[model samples]
Target: MDIKTASALHRLRLISVPEALSFPALLIFGSVLSRVSDIDFLMMPLGVLHGILFVIYGVMLLDVWVKAKWPFKKVLFFFVLSLIPFGGLYGDKVLKREEADSVVAARAREAAQA
Candidate 1:
């Protein structure tokens, strides 16, 4: 893949690790705090951030799905993985491996052409 494509995918892939983990943690914390006190205020920003990240993730998923032309099963796997805690970390690793392989293949093809 080209640098721009790789970079976009990587950014989304990396960001997902934290965002995925954060949502459940914040929700849990908010839920606990709500029982003790008010949490509507806290949830507002968190909800917005989650919404933005979700859109970014979905877009990146579509972008990479096309760029990589990944099988439907793999694409679905990444999407579902983003929802579970620590799953983003797993997805990042998988995507990184695929990206690396793509880069290597591109380089080899260029070398052959030269």
Candidate 2:
């Protein structure tokens, strides 16, 4: 991949793990807080933040999917993976492997050209 595409992929990969992890955490915390306290102030901000992150993650997922021209099965797998708690970490691991392989391939190509 070119630098810009690679950068975009990297950025999405970074955000995906944290956002995916955070959303479920906030959901659980908000649910618990709602039961225990009347003040439940944290829910609003956490909800909004999680919602925004969810949207961003979806958009980034689509962007990377198209840019990478991944198979539909792979795309679907990643989409589904985002829904489960801690699944993004697994996704990140897969992406990291792909990134490393791509970099090595790019280097090999460059060396061949030189």
Candidate 3:
């Protein structure tokens, strides 16, 4: 809802997406095993990176949920969204739209109070 929350979520969303997508691509590459053992071994690293990024994504989602005090359904949707391919990107877009809406509402409230 706040700019800081929006900004942090934006970054987490960006980071997690590429990490998650890389996992399956790397796995596929490993399976292909095109004559290079080292290349095939990269799968382990990819899995590690994806795991870490996924944890970070979860943390970021929780941060946003707490800051925005969003309803349970919205929070659940956000968690579910992160599991799909490029889901983080979609989550980022949704969060940004919500952030913009919050900004507009804030401005309106200020005007009203004045």
Alpha-carbon local distance difference test for all models: 0.76, 0.80, 0.69
- Which candidate tops lDDT? 2
Most TM-score-accurate candidate: 2
lDDT of 2 at 33: 80
Q: Rank the candidates by lDDT, best first.
A: 2, 1, 3
Would you estimate the TM-scores of all the predictions?
Answer: 0.83, 0.88, 0.70
Please identify model 1 stretches exceeding 4 Å from their true place: 1-5
Query: Which of the predicted structures, 2 or 3, would earn the higher TM-score when compared with the native?
Result: 2
Candidate 2 lDDT tens digits, 1-114? 644456657877888888877867887888788889885888888889888887888898888777777789998898888888888889889878777766676677788889
Please provide, for model 1 over 43-97, each residue's C-alpha lDDT reduced to its tens digit, 9 standing for 90 to 100: 7676677777778888888888787667899888988888887688888888787
Worst 10 residues of 1 by lDDT: 1-10
Better model by TM-score: candidate 1 vs candidate 3 = 1
Q: How accurate is candidate 1 locally (lDDT)?
A: 0.76
